[model samples]
Target: MTQSRPPLNAPHSTAQSAPGALPGTPLRSPADVLGTGVAFPIGVNPRGQLSMVSGERAVTQAILSLLMTARGQRVMRPEYGCRIHELVFAPGDATTLGLASYYVDEALRAWEPRIEVEQVQAQLDGQDTSRIVVDIRYRLKGNPEPRSLVFPFYRSL
Candidate 1:
């Protein structure tokens, strides 16, 4: 009778290392694995490789992203976004502008943790009544310097 043997590529029963992990390699910390810097949006560049952004530019982008997201849009976090789009259809007047500003402030405070909101102003365009200019001033967290962004919101008459 011939004796049978296990396959050469089969995993050893006594191996101590986890599957696919190299021996003696240390595991990375959560922060190290997640990274400390911000990553740019996918396909942001022509090359298709991921990119990074930091400092003022990154903060600006973050704020824009938060403001653009509508409530109930994010999965499992229905109240995490802003309702700025709804203001576009609202009657353009002093009271409406004040309400819009209040909404913007509230949304930013709830969603963005990197900045302290200084002011949010909504102004109707002089030449184009259908457009409203939203100016947001904020101070970055742990920094005294203030940054401002002006975004245009348009609505049909």
Candidate 2:
């Protein structure tokens, strides 16, 4: 004859809650809660001290970094950057300006998820041939107000 086993004291259903989590509450990842942050690059600020930013500010800095970096410059992620630098050598024309804007738009959409891009305008400076002005208009997530930034790139002739 076999002996009877004791009844289990565990909850009846594990599906009701996550492991180690309270009932009616679900677990969340860091990315889902805290926004992404990146340290300010060297020479970005004159303060000369390390600084980090989050939320809309972080997104803005990240956009500028991405735009400044040329594709293939980042190891192990050649496709992670935009080809904006190539615009420097390109003849300043409507088609070239449009292409630059397109590149910025594609790169932002692929990397930045915190903002909804409204418009990307790129144009060559009328007074300075070496300067290219790029204006990015976007609305940050969870924010109703729209924001914009103007990034100027100076190419060496």
lDDT of 1 by residue, 72-97 (tens): 89999989777777776878798777
List ranges where model 1 is wrong by over 4 Å: 1-41, 44-47
Runs with alpha carbons beyond 4 Å of true place in candidate 2 = 1-36, 42-50
Winner by lDDT: 2
**56-123: candidate 2 lDDT, tens digit per residue:** 56677888888878889999999988877777778878888898889889988887777789999998
Worst 10 residues of 2 by lDDT: 25-34
Candidate 1, run of 10 with poorest lDDT: 28-37
lDDT against true structure, model 2: 0.77
Best by TM-score: 2
TM-score per model over all chains: 0.68, 0.70
| Model 1: pairs clashing at backbone N, Cα or C within 3 Å | none
